[model samples]
Target chain A: MVEITIISGKGGTGKTSLTAAFAHLASNHVICDLDVDAPDLHLILKPENEYLEEFFSGHEAIIDQNLCSSCGECLERCKYNAIKETPEGLMVDLLACEGCKVCVHFCPVGAIEFPMRRCGQWYLSKTRFGPLVHAQLFPGEENSGLLVSLLRKQARGMAEKENYNLILSDGAPGIGCPVISSLSGTDLAVAVTEPTPSGSHDLERVVNLCEHFKIPVGVIINKFDINLDQVKKIENFCQDHGLSLVGKLPYDHAFTEAMVQAKTITEYQSGDLAEEIGRIWARIEALAQLKKAA
Target chain B: MIIALASGKGGTGKTTVCASLVRIWDKPVQAVDLDVEEPNLALYLKPELSGRLISEMEIPVSDQEKCTACGACSEICQFKAITVLGEYLLTFPEMCHGCGGCLAVCPEGALSLGARELGEVLWGQAGEIDFLMGRLRVGEAMSPPLMRDVKKRLDSSRDVIIDAPPGTSCPAINAVKDADVIVLVTEPTPFGFYDLKLAREAFTPIGKPMGVVMNRTGFGDAGAYDYCRATGLPILLEIPYDRRVAEKYSQGEVIADALPEFRGRFIELAARIRELAAGDLKEVSNG
Candidate 1:
């Protein structure tokens, strides 16, 4: 099977749109959205829920106030500053707690209880395109990287069970935890970026991260016509770094218009932009094939 | 007052709004780039960095000599960063959360503290603005620690504008949690509106007054506006979808610097934020 993950270091650079378009064009594939915290692909794909599972990871400390001796040992030993002496007596701030279990171990009275935190939920769903695996991490929750990994594993299992040949995933923004987990084992990491300076800078960082993980990378400059000069600079950088310049898409408003209707650009219209996306997908498929052969 | 410009989605103009606000503010203010993973505020602000410090976190390291194969350290570690095999102990520093639980649990006193490089904290000046930012080390999974490092330089005496990372997750929360007020910059689209609701839900518990700045106003629908009205998140500013602004932003030019008209709008935005913050504070005092 060939696995390709679409990622952009900077947010709002059309990763989900392009991934959805690719999913529409590709056959015998499973789609996955790894942007758990702020997922947008579901809005476009409109997946129908098939199975839902709660994701529990890590632990949070809860003080049993009734059994507490009020010794303040948990507060002093807690490095995260999560335990606070509030008006209702000592309390644990759920947001601040790192779930290290230090309080539970160090409490002389054993008043601290460490319980698994329900971080979020993952879903298996069916879209018009194919099977999809997605997740939603609770707001302000951590462990997004772990959640991404879990989704990717589920996607792989789905693809293998159905004998599918491809797995297309939309990754989170930034060169951080979730992005890392999404791109690590993929066959090709497609870095979708814009011609702007922020996009260029972030693309470089994310590409560097892909290189660190030894994953092959292909660059796609969306909205290339916005600034021709910036596009040229990005092209030169790609050449110098020996990265593949997969494709360049012009500035288009159909992306937003189609999104307004909850449709992928390809499904919304058969215009030049959709055609260009098809061509880009062709190029990415060629690269994926090449990687597989090697 | 500390004003944080954040978004539920990436590339929603958090840095753009932050850079412009710092330019039009009438007084010397601190501009902090809390998006350490992909910091872009310095690109627009052009800060001449005056100081740099390496940000590091402590992880436990074990000495083999005094180590008994007891599994207390591994048992207490919630992150599974450390594992004790039959005769050897393995440590994965990247997975470590630096909570020091392993060290505290080791009865043989074989574990010691070792510093792991997180990133770099830089402080400088962008004309009259005091600039500070953090750059996370490449491949580093954690960001909240580095964000905390950058926030250590926050000059509370001066007005602060924080450019927060996008999303409604832990890193975004860590950046804006302490701000007196938050300006959620979002485009007017389905994706933008959906994530805006999530961001609002995430940040509401912080109890800080927040408003919305509608960007790319001409395009997309009114979902964001309707949601804002229903939730009482005042619409603070509406930057139209102008090609000139896009071009200037593409070139890394601050909108307030390149366009005369935007300077007035940004100045007005700063004023409106101040009034909102003051009003919230007054209500808090009365309550």
Candidate 2:
């Protein structure tokens, strides 16, 4: 199976919207939203969750007051400064705790309890397009990379079991842990970007990351009309880097309008934007060596 | 006071707002870009970087000669950064959270600290504003550590404006955690409104006061406004959607410099942020 991931180093540059559009255009593909921290693909795909699973990764140090001797040993040994001497008693600040478990390991009286943190939830859902694998990381939680890998694995398993030939994934913003997890091992990494300086700047970083992983990249300039000069610069950069310049989408309110209506651009209306997206998907399929939808 | 500009969704103009506010603020504010991964604040601030330092995280280095392969070090690691397979010991520094647990649990004292290049921290001056930012090494998974390294340069004596990364996860939280107040910049769209709520949910537990700056207004839905009203999150400022502003922003021009008319708005935003931060401090002291 060929796996294609849509990513943008900068967020909100039409990654989710374009991924949803590609999902609508692709045939026999399992959709996966690897932006577990703040997933938006579901807003358009309208997935009805078919299976749910709790995700537990890493460990959080919980202090048991009953077993505590108030020796301050755990406090002194904690590197994260998560152990706070509060007015009530010694408390563990959940936000500051990095789940290192140093306090649990070093506790003299065994007052610190190390339990697996329920980071978030993953789901296998049914969308109009196909079966979607997505997940959500609880607010203020870490280990997003692990959760992203889990979702990607589930998508691959589903594709194999269901005989789907394509796995289309929407990756998280930023070239961070979660983005790395989403980008690795993908057949094609389609970077969706805008014409803004920030867009091009971040796109370069994402492209560098793709090159580091030796993954083939295709560039799509979303909102290309916002800055024609910047678009020329981006095009030149792609040419200089020998990266595939797949498509350019104009600045259209239809994207947001369609999102407001809980629909993809293709589902909302078959205008220039939808047609452009279709062409882009065809180019991506060709680049990934996947058979085009009949 | 430290004010953080963040949004759950990216490209909602956090860097634009941050750079504009720093330009118009009436003091020598310290501008920190905590978005180590793909930091773009420097593109707008145009800081003349005077100093650069490599930021490194400590990972366990094993002494094979002294190693017992007792699996004690690997057993204590939460990230599985270290593992013992048969008689060989392996270490994956990329996966290490730099918790130092393995070093502590090593029974034979075979594991020692080793540095892995996380990124670089650069500091300089942007006009009167003190500028600092972190650039994470490409392919590096860890960012919070690098972000912390940048924030270590925060001068509490001066007003600080931190441009936080997008998303309501650990990286974003680490940026805004120590701030006196957070300014959430977002557009007025369904995605924006939805992620705004998630950002609030993520940051609310930080116990710091938060406000919203509605950018690209006049288009999309009113869901963001309604969310703020319902959550009692005060709207600090609203920047209407303008092609001219966007064009200038695309060219790496600060909004306040590109359009002088918006200077008054940024000035107002700075004043409001100060008031909000000061008010929170007063409440804390009073309580």
Candidate 3:
């Protein structure tokens, strides 16, 4: 099975919208939302969660006053400063906990419990489109990378069982851990961007990241009409780097309108933008199976 | 004075504002571009390096001839970057977070710390600004260390401005954590509003005070305003959608050159940030 990941170096460049539309176009594909930190794909796919799983990550050290020896050892041992002294005894602020188990190893009376931290939840759900894998990290949780890996594994398993041919993932913005995890096994990555200065700038960053992994990459310039000059610069850049300048989509209010209604532009209008996305998805599929698709 | 150009979301003119700030500074301002994971400040600045490029960390390389393929290295890795399956061993240096947990656990004297170039930290000057940027090596998993290296160049007397990477992830956290004050840059859009909330979550954990600068303001999304009201984060400046601004940035012009009025605004931004950094907001919030 081929995997195509849609990533933007910068966020809010409509990466998820494009991914959702491409998912619609790519039949027999298992869709996964790897942006576990602030996943908004659920806002659009509206996946009907079929199965849910609680992801228990390793723990932040919490002190028990009952077994407490106030030697002030735990307070100094915590590198995250998670342990704090209270009027009665010691307390642990769960959010600040790094789960490094520093205090647990050094606790004199074994007062510190290095229990698993309740970070987030992962889900296997059925969307109108197909089998969707998603996850939600609690507001203050820190294990987004783990959640992403779990979701990706679940999606891969589902795709294999269902005899699907593709795993289309929407990666979180930036060159962070989650993005790295999403790109780990991607066959092709389409870097969605705009014609603005930061857009072109951030596009190069994401493109560089894809290049690092030797992942075949394509560039999609969203709202290319906003600035033709910048578009030219970006096109020239893609050509120079041997990256396929797949398509240059124009600025359209239909995107925002679609988002408000939780619909992909491909679903709402089925017009030029949709047609363009269709072509791009086809190219992506071709790029993934470079020899076979050709 | 420290000027931080941070938008809630990516592609919302954070680097545009930083490029503008650097152009107008006209004096020697130490510009530390801390967006290490995908730093683009160098692209806009086009600055030549007057500094050395050095790798940030030394990864532990296993000498296959020296020892057995014991499972000790795999067991101690908090990152799980190393694993041994049967007679085969898999090592993903990209997954290594540089904790040295594996090296400490290795037996048979098999592991030796070898220089694996993960990324580079360099210092360069752009216009009147002494610029520093951290470029994470391709396939390198860790970025925080490179960002910290760039941040180590800060001179208290220099007018410092940081171009932070987008999102509230580890790289963003590493970029903005040590800033005296964080100036969140956002657009007046629903998407920007949503991600700005994510950025807010990142900032509150550090207990650092932050303000906002609204870019491309003509769009009728008042989510940024609503967010400001709810969180008490003041809106410092708003740059409306201007075609000239786009042209200047496209041609690698400083944002301040296209809109000269922003010089005072940024200078004032510096002052306001210092005031906020003087424990003003912390006192107010905790009071």
Candidate 4:
């Protein structure tokens, strides 16, 4: 199976909207939302969750007040500032806890108890396009990369078991841990970006990341008409780097309107924008196929 | 006082707002770009390089000669950064979280702290605005540490404006923490509205008052406005979608710099932010 991840180094460049539109075009594909922190694909796809699983990763120090020495050794030894000396006793701030287990190991009174922290939940859901594996990380929680890896693994497993040929993923913004986890082992990555300076800079960074991982990338310039001069610069950069400029989508209100309606651009309207997206998907497929043939 | 501009969704004009706010404010403001992964504040501000700070983290190195490979060090590692075999041990520096747990638990005193470069901080100046940006090393997973390093440049005497990274995760938290007030910049779309809620939930725990700036006012649905009104989040400013703004931003120009008309809006935003922050300060002093 081939996994094509749509990623933007910067956020709010229409990554999820484009992914949903592609989901409409690519039938029989397992969709995965790797943006566990703030997932929005479900808002568009409206997935009906079929299976839910609690994801437990990392650890948090739970102070046992009963063991109380009030010695404050754990508080002194904690580097994360997770242990706070309350009037009642030493309290652990789970949000600030890094799960380093330093307090648990060095507690002079052995008052610290370590437990596996439940960070978030992942789900296997059914959408109109196909089965989707997505997840949500609770507020003030870490381990985003771990959750993204879990979702991608589940998506790949479902794809193989169901004999689906494609696994399309929507990756989080920025070239951070979660984005790296999503990029791993993917066959092709579509870097959806805009024509702004930050957009061009971030696109190059994400493309460099893909290059570092030896993953082939295709560029999609969203809102390309917003700045044609910047578009020319992006085009030149793609040419210099030998990256494929797979698509250039114009600025359209339909994308946001479609999102408000909880529908993909292809599903919400039948116009030039939809037609352009269709052509963009065709180019991405052709590029992926070309890589396979080579 | 320190104010932060953030949006859970990227490209919602956090950097633009930060640059514009710094330009319009008459005081010497510290414009900190805490989006270490892909910092763009320097791009807009055109800062002149003044200083640099290198941030490093400690990774564990095992001493084979002094050791009985009891696997104690590996056992205590939460990140699985170290693996101990019967005769040997291996360390993955990239996987290390620099927690120093393994060094503490080494029974034979065989594990020692070794330094690894996490990232660096660049401090510069754009006219009167002090610009500080953290840059994470490419392929590095850790960013919060670098963010903390960048924040070391915080001069409390000067007004500070932090441009936080997108997403309501540890990185974003690290950037916006300790700010007196936070300004959430977002467009009026379903995605924006949803992520704005997430951002609110994440920062609400910081116990700081926040307001919203609806960017691209005419571009999307009014979901963001509804969310702000329902949550009682003050609308600090609304920047309508204009091709000129987009064009100027594409050319690495700050909005207030390119369009003098937007300076009044930014000035008003700064005043409102100060007004809100003063109330928070009063409550802090009272309590």
lDDT tens per residue, model 2, B83-112? 999999999988898888898888898999
Which candidate has the top score in DockQ?
A: 1
Query: How high is the CA lDDT of each candidate model?
Result: 0.91, 0.89, 0.75, 0.87
Backbone clash numbers for all candidates listed: 1, 0, 3, 1
Off by over 4 Å in 1: B280-287
RMSD of 2: 3.2
- Tell me the tens digit of each residue's lDDT in model 3 across B25-126: 655688777777667777778788988677656566777776577787776565666787785566777656565556656767777776667678888776
Which prediction has more favorable DockQ, 1 or 4?
1
Q: Show where candidate 2 strays beyond 4 Å.
A: A290-294, B280-287
Question: How does model 4 fare in lDDT?
Answer: 0.87
Question: Which digits, one per residue and each the tens of the lDDT, describe model 1 over residues A1-294?
Answer: 999999999998888989999999999999999999899999999999999999998889999989888889888888777888988789999998999998899998889888899999999999999999999999999989899999999999988988999999998889998999999878999999998889999999999999899999999999888899999999999999889999998878898999999999999999888888899999999999999999
Tens digits of per-residue lDDT, candidate 3, A1-294, equal 888788887766789888888877778889999877667687678899889888888766778889998899778755445687889899987755666555676677999887777877888888888988988766556667777788888888888898998898998777766787888767888899888666887787778777777888888988787689889999899999999988888877777667667787789898877888889878777778893364
Clashing pairs in 4: A11-B10
Among these predictions, the greatest lDDT belongs to 1
What TM-score would candidate 2 get against the native?
0.96
**DockQ for each of the predicted structures, in order?**
0.84, 0.73, 0.25, 0.70
| Residue lDDT tens for model 2, A1-294 | 999999999987889999999999999999999999889899888899999999998788899988888899878877677899987789999887888878888888889888889989999999999999998888988788889999999999998998999999999888888998999888999999999878999999999999999888999998888789999999999999888999999878888899889899999998777988899899999999942231
Clashes of 3: 3
lDDT of 1 at A156: 94
The RMSD of every model to the true structure, in order and in angstroms, is 2.5, 3.2, 4.7, 2.9
User: Judged by DockQ cut-offs, is candidate 1 incorrect, acceptable, medium or high?
Assistant: high
